[model samples]
Target: MTDLAKTDRPRTPVLDRVTLPSDLKGLSDRELRQLADELRAETISAVSVTGGHLGAGLGVVELTVALHAVFETPRDKIIWDVGHQCYPHKILTGRRDRIRTLRMGGGLAGFTKRAESPYDPFGAGHSSTSISAALGFAVARDLGGDPGDAIAVIGDGAMSAGMAFEAMNNAGHLGKRLFVILNDNEMSIAPPTGALSTYLTRLYTGGPFQELKAAAKGAVSLLPSPMQEGARRAKEMLKGMAVGGTLFEELGFSYIGPVDGHDLDQLLPLLRTVRARADGPVLIHAVTKKGKGYAPAENADDRGHARGRFDVLTGQQAKAKSNAPSYTSVFARALIDEAGRDDRILGITAAMPDGTGLKQFAERFPRRTFDVGIAEQHAVTFAAGLAAGGMKPFCALYSTFLQRGYDQIVHDVAVQGLPVRFAIDRAGLVGQDGPTHAGAYDIAFLSNLPGFVVMAAADEAELVHMVATAAAHDAGPIAFRFPRGEGTGVEMPERGEILPIGRGRMIAEGHSVAILSFGTRLSEAMAARESLSARGISPTIADARFARPLDRDLILKLAAGHDALITLEEGAVGGFGSHVAQLLADEGVFDRGLAFRSMVLPDRFIDHDAPYAMYDDSALNAAHIEAKVLEVLKIGQLDRRA
Candidate 1:
């Protein structure tokens, strides 16, 4: 696992000829092993440049090569769960040319995309979806489609999710000929959690029971042909004693070995065997190591799950130093401070303790923190139960991932009026992850629920106050959202203060126009105010902290004082802006001569790019703000330019 340099990449003469999976069919097992090594090297090199997902792809390199070599892809659909491990698949399936452009604007996607290639039968960025998608392809194939032998390569971490089990149950009932490769690397972004992970661990690491079962199997054949029925019963008993894969068998799936995923010799033969002679549903437990080949990734924490651009020689990531603290860190510190005083406080994350800054909270209060694996739906309900039992549960989740638990949020928390604090991270235009991970619809969705208090932090300092506010308020469900990047370099507060609910602060008072913003777009609104002032138009700027409560007095005051009012937020159309418009329309404010406008994220999914560029594309930037103001003021575009 020596570090690679730009000029000293591994030689892949065989891989150079493999432009498609069809080409892989011609190679021998030895050549395929060599190609796997080359593919692993290529994947590392590509990810080093692009700085996307690394460890999962490295772990699955041999599997990807073997799958391509054995299966007739494009016709034989291979669906990658979460798609993080699809880098090697992308490289082999004729996307190697654009590999370095991973997650870039107008370039290769970091995950498997059906539209990007013929080999990608289904697209996925989120986890635990491949099994269901592959089952659909299987059903379609049975009903007179050409989608051959549907295969789903899902991680063990993904298998912990409820959706995977739902799909497996249905697939088992249908008894379809499907292949589910359980890539049991013992990690998924974070160290795997929950009962399924424990079961898989027992399967791979033989315990006392497994040893007894093995001994029993060896002795079972000693019985005479007249006692063959007894031997068959003994074998079934041995299988029952075997610690792993018994649950899968009970669900009507034929369980196969806990094989070595990295070993090409093991992978090639087993996969070929399954492809040739498998009926009904089959689960192949292939144990692998995340960040398998590369030393830097293997040695590091998280096994190099996700990384920034780094020096291949030293494994030194080129992280840009930020003077300001990240929004995540700010929220983490605030929550830690509050939790120290309030012993009733408890924290929960679905699977993203690190991503949502709950790792810091967990370090401080280990007993109070819970990582519920990748089950968001369970996390929400679990938090609701904690709240019902009189614990102040802060259910922290990414805005995108929160969509998975909406039903639970509605039924358990919102409907029952549980006091669950939702500390939502990654709440806006996350730069490279794109629309698949965007936090666009949370505000609209959450604000619509009765008795739900939705707040967005305007800056890191404001986030501290909101954290305190959410902690202090125990009446009902409260949520506060913050964006992905660093804060605005605002001065630190000694401690958070619990501000009044449903109130906003005015930054400046001006005539003719008032710009009311709901989230971190306050900075853009202020910048637009400066630009407007230079053109002899001084617009008032206000920050609406609460989206749900509507800040009736502040909004009404602004509407009455200003000739034109513009509502801005970093959410979708039906969010804060839409709520304000509804209030204005209901109050008959818009019926008068008040020219109103709501500037929100455009009515489409924006692609991966720099945050500012994505904002510009969505028409929510400073310039766009200025243009909206001018348009509301009845100023022509040409005149404004002049």
Candidate 2:
């Protein structure tokens, strides 16, 4: 719509010749710099069309070129920590042709995927995993593997996670020769917050320590004596009067930088020197801006972290107007309303303030909102502590990310019977982000936890009541999951009411067949009911709000009253439907000759696509539900065939 595809394509003479990283080996430093510029242009151009991560790839353009030019990828391993910045890497490693297809169905993945390319030795969607993976590669090389060098390019925000430190400690203990390039962009998806962020800020800005440089040179005794003296002084001057890298040195790594990541002249030499001279582990701190070039991205909020198709010239995103409010907004407003009434209510999110919709809540109640930096485990336990201390804590997280804190859920909250309320966003097949971000397992995982109250909203209105229900429930851990997109245009309640804990309300009454729905799939069930009605089969429809507490009375009544019963949910197999089946089994409803079926997400991981398309592929859409009902009833289709 904005002519982004035309009049904005950058001329890339140097980049045109490069089909692979091997081609970069022959180029001069000046040519490589030219190529980086072209690559950056190409990255921007490609992302403008496809709309994936813009700022991260832009930030690491020079670093990506430098890493590939210096190291023989597919032989030497370079693992990107979060993979959001790997678009430039993908471009260099012969994925340029399909770069525009990122996150599309059957297209190149948004993250570094091992299955997509040989150069991607490891796959990653989550952050803070590169260090450990690189260490594994390093150890593998030591144990007679072919990998030449193991390099991990990780962002500063990723370093805040406990896993990175754990990996660093192990690599230090093992005394392996490893290279860790700390890409200090001063940001993640949200502006990073933690002591580590402050430490990194101080590391580059604080005065230089000549002793720190000398210690680094001393640690790598393999360097030639003449070069060692020159390198030590060079490092000292480059460090800029800062007593930095002491923390890394204590962990058994020779710290080398605080260098300009965007400058090819500085990056190429620093990297080449490290590749040639380092005897043991080396940590290079490379400072960079998150959105390095392209005025639009650099100037925008979020630093153009993720975007839709946009006007390349103006940086205006092409966002379609939503017909209804997003489920996230509904949850946020509901929580904010509840928090206003209760002073003890506190909100917590792992690293996502905007993604979890806590940004607005924080604006209203800044003191009560806690963003624990990409540490889900800490967030869960922290919320548990808040609940333990007579506070009402809502631990809101994307359903997939909450998997990281599963142990905390079981040990700290569920087992201890803490009153931490979990508001799970992105609770179904999220479009474009693929299976890595899907919220498929949360229902199954949380429903099984002892004394846990699990609910799923049928619509935005139901979400409000569920939030209130969660706020009032101080008996144990309660969680409610909602999908990623807009609600079904239902009228929103002015205020939420606290409903009975385990009761499901009937929507439509019929005799022959019944459809019991949970979560957002209630819409599909209603549609299926209409189709059945057209065929003179007016099937009953009910919304099962709670999943953990088997709505025994409602379920049994549906089972007894109907000739056939179908359970539906937007979750994996062992969730609402499975629980319903289990309850029916225990109550001997199956012995009464009631034909039953459960419709849920299939066993396989659904790939990235539009949400409706994904559901259709999973055979959980309205048409699929109608077909299943017809087949189960042995009606029109069976009669016709017979």
Candidate 3:
């Protein structure tokens, strides 16, 4: 049962008929307009229960309807960039039956997935990938793959990334019959930044409202019915203005639009014209408002970019309150506290100030903070430059997105040995957003980098100390990762302490087996120990705070004394555990009759689910740990075998 009762469901008469995009082909333009309205209402009702990206989907309802109505979809590829705005697309593509299951385990993905349906064409989660994927489809179609037109729907914020421009430049060179729809909603997850956004806004900025409205009326003379169409919306006539796509034109594409994306009159005719007449790469600039129909979403700061399950009538989210502060908030407070002690401490994020908790830092020290739009590569190198100039620059990014700048991290920061503080957030299997957004590889990648110091906080208290440690250390690159969501209700320090580099901390002492853990998995190790204790096996537990340096003495002591040893981390293979095994092998500890095992996230992409459920699937929880310990212990193994 959905959150909304069946009786409360909106009457979607036109939408009821739209079982698939093909069903939409017969609807009249007027009926299409009615369908767009009904689609918006249905989108709101579904997302109200499922709690996904409401605003973007709502904004594109008309566009979604118009595209399906005009194009032969499932054949003509429509690739949605970032894929958050694909909720409405999903509805039209025969997934409405599972629409309520958005972002849940074994349900509809929050972003587009290729495996989901034939209509998807290409999958995308991160921003700025649509054009490149669309171009590939276009080339493939010409080279005897699946036949169809290729269209890429990208947002203004995604356009800020260098890859988008690279794709555009390539598409221009290919000179293929492709469509790039620039959905200028004036928002990404964060408010869009950079000059391109400013340039896009200027397209419709200076026109007088009345004159633009009148110009819209004038265009109806060209239409079949002037009087009826002119009265419908003068906003559509605004497309008649000389809105030049100079930037897109320079890149080898013909440009059309500045059209109101919500107006089917504008969208239908414009898309119809381009589809029929375009010969080379064509870019259509559709001006849309994020959260177009819903008042609450329109008024919200993020324009309902993301939300929790909410009451449709009140927009009241059913969010469970947590007593503990979020790791993000703790990191923010710690960074703020440390910055107060040092004038040179600076904060930076790649268009995720709010997500990374740098919004608070930006509030306290506006000049000292920098949000470099969606350009992660630029943000990384920019931070490196700032660090080289004697500033303590903390480049904060989600571990997944930070991969975009791995080259910059290697060449500019790591090679030069700059004192750049990397604050990698969401450093584990992030739930709901699924595999694309999982922060699983940062440990493996960063740990191996020469002179790079890697640390993971076992709890919120340790995060504070790591923040202070990063601030105080003016040597090479240093990073500390913490998981998403709240801390474990641990007591927080008023200020951070500078922890000694490459040191591990002992949490408990026992015999037979020693459980060495890194990151938030330390808590799970402790739980496993408790379970093991009841079976007459009290396993030793230690937190290996540093992954890079390995805490040589601490690790050697644990391995030499224990009959069995295990390493745990929230990352994948070749990460913390792999490093530990390499160490044990190097020291010939494996020959000392010490049994060793490493528990990690399995080498596969775990799908969207609750964090606990996903962790359970990875077998990194307490029960799995207990079983591993039991299997490793010789006496316990013998008892089980007998």
Please list the C-alpha lDDT of all candidates, in the order they appear.
Answer: 0.87, 0.88, 0.87
The alpha-carbon deviation from the true structure for residue 435 of candidate 1, after best TM-score superposition, in angstroms, is 1.1
Overall local distance difference test of candidate 2:
0.88
* Predicted candidate 2 versus true structure: per-residue lDDT over 1-642, tens digit per residue: 122346567788899899999999999999999898888888888888888899998999999999999999889999999899999999889999999899888899899888899999998888899999999999999999865899999999999999999999998889899999999999999999999999989866753322224344464344333334545665655566434677787889888666778888767866776688777888988889987878888887789899999878887889879789999999999999999999999999988999889999999999999999999999999999999999999999999999999999999999999999999999989988888888999999999988999999999999999999999999899999999989999999999999899999999988788999999988988888887777788889999999989799999999999889999998999999999999999999899899999998999988888788899999988888888889888864523332
User: What is the Cα-based lDDT of residue 380 in candidate 3?
Assistant: 96
Q: For model 2, how big is the CA root-mean-square deviation?
A: 3.3
Candidate 1 lDDT? 0.87
Provide the lDDT at 339 for model 3: 90
Worst-scoring 10-residue span by lDDT in model 2: 207-216
RMSD of 1: 4.0
Q: Report the poorest 10 consecutive residues by lDDT, candidate 1.
A: 207-216
| Number of residue pairs clashing in candidate 2, backbone atoms closer than 3 angstroms, sequence gap of 3 or more or interchain | 4
Model 2 / residue 192 / CA error / Å: 0.9
Query: Residue by residue across 1-642, what tens digits does model 1's lDDT show?
Result: 323665556567888999988998889988898888888888888887889899999999988998888898888999999988999999898988888899988988887877799988898989999899989989989999875999999999999999999999999999999999999999998888988998898777872111112224464233223333433443565554754567887787877656678878767766776677677888877889999988899998799999898777777898988899999999999999999999999999988989989999999999999999999999999999999999999999999999999999999999999999999999989988888899999999999999999999999999999999999999999999999999999998999999899899999998888999998999998898888887788899999999989899999999999999999998999999889989999999988889999998889988888889999999898888888888888875524454
Candidate 3 TM-score versus the reference = 0.94
Q: Which ten residues in a row have the lowest lDDT in candidate 3?
A: 208-217
